[model samples]
Target: MSSVLLFNKPFNVLCQFTDDLGRETLADFIKNPGFYAAGRLDRDSEGLLVLTNDGQLQHQISDPKHKLPKTYWVQVEGQIDSTAIDKLCKGVVLKDGLTKPAQAQATSEPDWLWPRNPPIRERQSIPTSWLKLTITEGRNRQVRRMTAAVGFPTLRLIRTQVGPFKLDGLALGQSQLIKQTNLLK
Candidate 1:
């Protein structure tokens, strides 16, 4: 049987086990050996990271061809309107090309959210808003770029779900090992 590790990666922590620059990494949080990350969560982003001991499972989870939907709760620099939400849902033209249509909507800040360390910078004159965005493709800084393309820069991003796994009930910088059979539930 394969093993899966669900990690709630904290901000500024590298997704890999080691970093040449002496930055915080998965090694600092996950002590389990023989497990490798299935996908990457950017260092600046906080959220669920899936790791697996089986190579085939890793490929299935990370491969864009699988089209596993990943969801994020984003805090943008300005109040987002329906127009921006519509654009995000329809597909935003990116430098790489047009992004796949995503599920996006303006949302209220989640009450269960934890405060980010070294809080995001605030501009008193410009109000911020929240968005729930789900995308099936993983591109470098894609979420940030998508929001920027819609005229709202992301100030903070927290991934809440990846496929059937979620960050729910997992605390910051924590890791939980799960039996492969339990993944679908």
Candidate 2:
């Protein structure tokens, strides 16, 4: 049977198991062998990172062709307005090309959220707001670029869900083994 691992990767941790620079990595938390990350999160971003022992399952989860929706809770530099939300939903033009339409809405910060180790820098005059954005394509730094293109730069980003899996019940730096049966359904 194949095995899956759900991990709530903390901010500033590398996705890989080893790092020559001695940065914190999956090795710091996960000790199991044969499992590898299905998808990658930037070292600066945090949220649900899926790992699997089966190579076929890894490709199924990480391949963009699957069109699995990834949701993020974004803290932006300004009070994001409807216009920006609409732009995000309508597909913002990026250097790479126009992004696929995304689901976006202004939202309040989650109450269950944990504090970051090194807090995000804040501007006294510029207020920040939260947004819940969902996208099917996982382009490199796509969310950050999209938000910035719409004039609201991301202050902090935390992914909350990916496909059927979620960050629910996992604490920062925590990892849990999930039965394959639970994931396939």
Candidate 3:
């Protein structure tokens, strides 16, 4: 049997279990030796990261062909409205060509959220808004680009969910392992 771990990675941490630059690594939190990250979370982005001790299972979870929906809780520079939501759900055109259709809905901040270190610049005049977006594909900086294309630059990005897994109860830099079959539910 394989082990699947769900971790809520914090901002500014490398996704790898080891860091050659002497920075924080998964070893700082997760002690499981054989487990490896199934996919990547850019150092700039924080949230749910799935890990597994089985190589084949790692491939299945990280591969885009699996079409696992990756959900994000993004805070943008300006207010978000129906028009922006529509464009995001409809797909935004990026230099990589048009993105795949995704689900987007206005949402509120999670309860007991902590402020980011060296927090995002606040434009005293403009307010930020939260939006829930689920995309099956992961492109480099895709979420940031999509929101920017709609006139709202992304300020803070957090991956709140992945497939059947949620970030709930997993604090920053903490992880919990679940049975592989749970992914199907």
My TM-score estimates for the predictions, one after another, are 0.97, 0.97, 0.93
Off by over 4 Å in 2: none
Task: Record all residue pairs in model 1 with backbone atoms less than 3 Å apart, i.e. clashing.
Answer: none
Better of 1 and 3 by TM-score: 1
lDDT at residue 163 of model 2 (Cα atoms): 91
The digit string of per-residue lDDT tens for model 3 on 43-111 reads 888889999888887888889899889999999987899999999989999999999988999888767
Residues 28-67 of candidate 1 have per-residue lDDT tens digits of 9999999999999999999899999988888889999998
Worst 10 residues of 2 by lDDT: 176-185
lDDT score at residue 91, model 2, on the 0-100 scale? 100
Q: What is the lDDT of residue 179 in candidate 3?
A: 62
Q: Residue 90 in candidate 3 has what lDDT?
A: 93
Query: On a 0 to 100 scale, what is the lDDT of residue 72 in model 3?
Result: 92
Every candidate's lDDT: 0.93, 0.93, 0.86
Off by over 4 Å in 3: 180-182
Ranking by TM-score: 2, 1, 3
What's the TM for model 2? 0.97
